[model samples]
Target: MTVMRRTGWFTKSIAAAGLLLMAGQASAALWSITYPRPLSENDLRSEYPVALLTLALEKTGVKYSLLPSDRILLQGKALRQLKENREVNVVWSMTDAQREKDLLPIRIPIAKGLIGWRVFLTTKDQLKYFKAVSSTDQLMKMTPVQGEEWPDTKILQANGFNVYTVPEYPQAFSILQSGRARLFPRSVIEVLNELESDDLPADIVLEPKLALHYPTAMYFFVNKGNATLARLIETGLERALEDGSFDALFRSTYQETLDKLDLENRTVFELDNPSLPPATPVNTPDYWLRPTRQE
Candidate 1:
C-alpha cells in the first residue's frame, strides 16, 4: 500500500512540472512592447493602441506583453531607444519622409486614416473669428499651435500657416487660452474628449465651421533593422483587416466620437502633406474611413 501511494504521488508531481514548463514557455513567447509616452489620467490616448496591438498579435499567434503604463518614455527618448535597439521595441506615429527613412514603418494606418482629419480647439472668445473664415488661405493668417517636434508643425508651415510650437502638450492649451495661438489643431477623435476632460481649460471650445484634412496617416514603427518584427505586425494587421476584426475594433473604439462630430455638417479644408513618403499606400480605399455625404 505504501509503494502504490508513492507511485501515485510521483506521477502527480511529474504532471505538475510539465504544466509549469509549458506555462513558462508560453509566457516567454510573448514579445513585450510599450507606448512611447507616459500614460495620463485620460484612458483614451492609450486604449486604441492597446486594443489594436492585442488583436493584431492574436491574429498572427504572435504573443506580446505591453509593458505597464508607468514604463513609458518620452517620444524623443523612445525614438532614440528604438534606434539603438534597446528596451523599447515598437511605437506608433504620424508618418513623414524622414521617419520612414529612419524607422521600419508597418505602413498600415492604425486609425483607418481618421488621424489625418483634424479639428481646431480655440478659446470661446476666438470662436466668432473662425466663424467668419471660409478658406484655408484665410485661416492661415491666424496663428496655430502644435507640439515642438510634431510632424504636423512642419506640414502646417509647408501649407503656409504660421504655427506656434511648444515643448509640452499642456503648454499648447495654455498658449491657446492666452490668445498667443488662436488655433490648436487636435485629431477629431481626440478633441471631443479633451473638451470634456476636467483637467482641460473650460474656456476652450471646438470650432464648429471647419475640419482640416491632410494626406498623413499614423503607423506602427520599429527599428529599421527589425524587419522580422515589422513583418509580424504587418501580416497580423493585414489578416485582421481582411477578417473584419480591424474595422470592428476601430468602430467599437471611436463610434461615439464619430457620431458626435456630425461630419456631414462641417466643411473639410484639405491640405497637402508634402512629407508623406512615396511608399504610402494611399490607393487603398479599404483602409480609409469616409464621412457620410450630406443630402
Candidate 2:
C-alpha cells in the first residue's frame, strides 16, 4: 500500500542521514555495499529491508557506503553478481542449500518469517470453491499460478500440486483476472502491496480461508569470502534483535498487513520446504512469527 510509500521515504532519509554521519573514518576497512537496483524508479518495497541493513551498519559504527547497482538486477542476476563479487556485494533473498553455500547468510530472516505465509489471489467467483477446501488434497484439486523459475514452484510440485507457471511474474495476475487460472498464491507480505495497483481487475481479491505456510528464510547474503562484511551485518542484526529495534522495525513495516490478513483465525496448510538449507535457524522461536492458531 501507499503506507510504506509515505513512511518509507522518511526511513530512507534517516538511513541516508546515518550514512552521512559515517563519512570520513577508518578508510582501510571502509567498503561499499552495493544492493540491487529498484524494480522501477518508484519501487519502494525495499525500503524496510534497506532501512534494516542501514540500522545494522549504524549499529556497527562502521564507515560503509550503500549503493544500488548502476542498472536493474533481478533476483537471480543479483545473487549471481554477489557470488561473483561483481556489481552487487549484498542481496536479501530466501535461502536455499546452494545459495547458503555460495554466499554468507545472516541466518535471521529479514521479514521475521512473513515471507513464507502465502494466500491465494483469485477472482470473486472462486471464493466458494476455495472456502470449501479443508484439506491439502482438496486444495490441490485446482491448479494455482506461479512464476516460471520460482523455487516455490518446485516446492509446490513436490507437494503434488500442479502449478501453472508464467514467464513474467506479472502475467500470473493477468492469468487470474482472465479466468485462465483459478488461483495465484502470493506471499502474505506482498498481497497488499500488489493490490494497491489501480490497473488490476476489480474482481481479483484475496482468498482468505485457506492459506499456505512454509519456511521462508530471507537473509542478507554477501560473498562467502566477505567474512568481515558478513560479520558486520550479522552483528548489527543480532544487536538490533537484542535491543528490540529489529522487531520494532519489522512490526512497523508489516504489522498493518498482518493484522489485515487475520492469519491466526484462518486454516493454515503447512507445507514442506526441502529447499531450506540445513543452516537455517528454524529452531530459534524468537526469529519467527508464530501465530497462536496455526494448524
Candidate 3:
C-alpha cells in the first residue's frame, strides 16, 4: 500500500510538470514580419530593418517568422489586413500618420533621416536656364512631372509651376535625358548612385538647390494589441544598443557595402566617425532608441 501511494504521488507530480511545460510553449508568441522588398543580391541587407529585428529576436529569445513583400504598397496592404484580422504582428520601415494610431514602434530607428533637397540634372548646354533658380519657388515656373508625390513637386505646383508626375523615378530621369523634360530633381545620393551606374555624359550636371524638406521617420511597427511583444522588442533593442552588440552586428554585415558605395568615408547621422558607433554609452534614450509611429 505504501509503495502504491508513493508511485501515485510521483505520477501526479510528473503530470503537473508536463502541463506547465505545455502552457509555456503555448504562450510563446509567433510574429509575422513583412519587409519592403524581396531579398536581392544587391539589396542593402545590413540596413534592412527586418535583419535588425532578427538580431533583436536572437537577443530576446522571441519567436518570429518573416514574409517579404515585393514593394511598399504590398507591405502596406498586407499589414493592414493583418491589423484588421488581428493576425499580423509586425511590419518594418513603414512611414505614415495613420499607421501610428494602430501600431506601436520599436525604439530604434530604421532609416537615417528624411531626405531633403533636390538637384536639377540636365545636359551641360541646358544648365544656363536653371542657374538663377535657387529655390523650389523659382523653379516652379517650368513644366515638370505631374501627379507624383516627389519631394519638391507639390511645393512647386502650389507656387504656380506646371508640374507633371511620372510613373517612376527612372522614368523621370529618362524624360530629362531624352529632352522630354528640362529638369529632374532627386536626392544627391540617389543621383550619384545612378550616375555611377550609367555614366552620364559630361553635359549632365546636377544643380545644387534646396527643393523641399519633409518630415519622415522609419521604424519597426508592431500591432498595438501585441503590447507584450512590442515591449520585449523595445527592451531587447535597448540592451543590444547598450552592450555594443547592435553596432557590431551592423558593421559585420554592412562595412563592406559601405566601402563599395563610397559611403564609408561619410558619417552616419549619429556617429562622428564613418564607422558604426559603439552601442555602449548610448546615453540619450530619444537620441537613437526612441520609438516613433506614423500613419
Candidate 4:
C-alpha cells in the first residue's frame, strides 16, 4: 500500500512539472519587426525614434527579428501577416484604414509629431509670381506636388487646389527642381536636408513663408491577436519614456542629423506652425477611418 501511494504521488508531481515547463515555453516572448526598405545604413544608424525603439527592445531581453520590405507598400503585407498570426509581430509607422481593423496600435508615439512645412520655391525669374499670394487660398492656384498620405494634402485639396499626388519625397523634389511643378510641399526639415545636399540645384531657393503646417503623431502597431506580446511592448515603451531613455536616444541619433542639415536651431513648433488648427492632439488614440461595407 505504501509503495502504491508513493508511485501515485511521484506520477502527479511529474505531470505538474511537465505542464509548467510547457507553459513557460509557450509564454516565451518572440517578436518580428518589419520596416520599410531601400533603407540606408545611415537611416538605421541615425534615424531618431526608430533607432531608439530598436535599442529599447534589445534592452528588455525580448527576442526580436527585423525584416525589411523592399517597398513601402509591402509593409501592408507584413501587417496583414501579423494579423493572421503568421509569426510577424510588429510594423513601424504605417498609416492605412484597412490595417487598423486587425492590428492593435501601441498608443505611445514612437517619434515626435509628423512635421510638414509647405513652401513655394522658384527660380529668380518666377519669384514675383509667388510673392503676390498673401494667403494659402491664393497660393493654391499654382501647381504643387502633393505628397501622398501627408495630412496636409487633404487641407490643400479641400480649398480648391489642384494637388498632384506623388509617390515619394524624391519624386516630389525632382518635379520641383525640374520645373515640372512650381511649388513643393514637404517636411521643411527633410527638404532642407535635401537642398543642402549635392543633388539639388543651386539656383533654386525655398520661400521664407510656410503655406501650411501639419503635426501628426506616429505609432508602433502590433497584432491584436498577440495580446501578450503587444502588452509587453507597450509597457516597455512607456517605461522607456518615463526613464528618459527615449529622449537620450533621440538626441544622440537625430540631433546630429539635424545639425548637418542646418536645422538644429529650429524648434518642432517653428517647422510646423503649431498654431494651425488641424494639428493632431498629442497622445490621442489612433484615429482609424473605417471603410464602408458593401451590401
> Which candidate ranks first by lDDT, i.e. highest?
2
Off by over 4 Å in 1: 1-28, 69-72, 292-295
Candidate 4 lands at a TM-score of 0.61
* Prediction 3 global C-alpha lDDT: 0.50
Candidate 4, superposed: residue stretches over 4 Å from native: 1-29, 39-46, 70-89, 94-103, 116-133, 148-152, 178-180, 196-205, 223-229, 253-295
lDDT of 3 by residue, 96-154 (tens): 43555556665465433322223446666666776576455555565565325332454
Give TM per candidate: 0.86, 0.84, 0.52, 0.61
Give residue 39's lDDT in candidate 2 (0 to 100): 70
Residue lDDT tens for model 2, 150-232: 77887899889988888766678788777767899888777887677555578888887778998877789899888667766
Worst 10 residues of 4 by lDDT: 286-295
List the pairs of residues colliding in candidate 2: none
How would you encode candidate 4's per-residue C-alpha lDDT over 1-295 as one tens digit per residue? 0001125788989855754564465348566665555334433312544575676665556677766544543334555566775544566542333444556766555655433333455555456677566665567577777666554566566556687777555566667666667777544334555556565567667665444444444566667776555555665665676687876765554455444433322221122322333323343433221111223
Error of 3 at 232 (Å): 3.6
In order of listing, the candidates' clash counts read 0, 0, 13, 0
Q: Which stretches of candidate 3 lie over 4 Å from their true place?
A: 1-32, 39-47, 70-89, 114-133, 139-212, 247-295
RMSD values for the candidates in order, in angstroms, are 11.7, 8.9, 13.0, 12.5
Displacement of the residue 83 alpha carbon in candidate 1, Å: 2.2
Give per-residue lDDT, candidate 3, residue 108: 60
Task: Name the best candidate (by TM-score).
Answer: 1
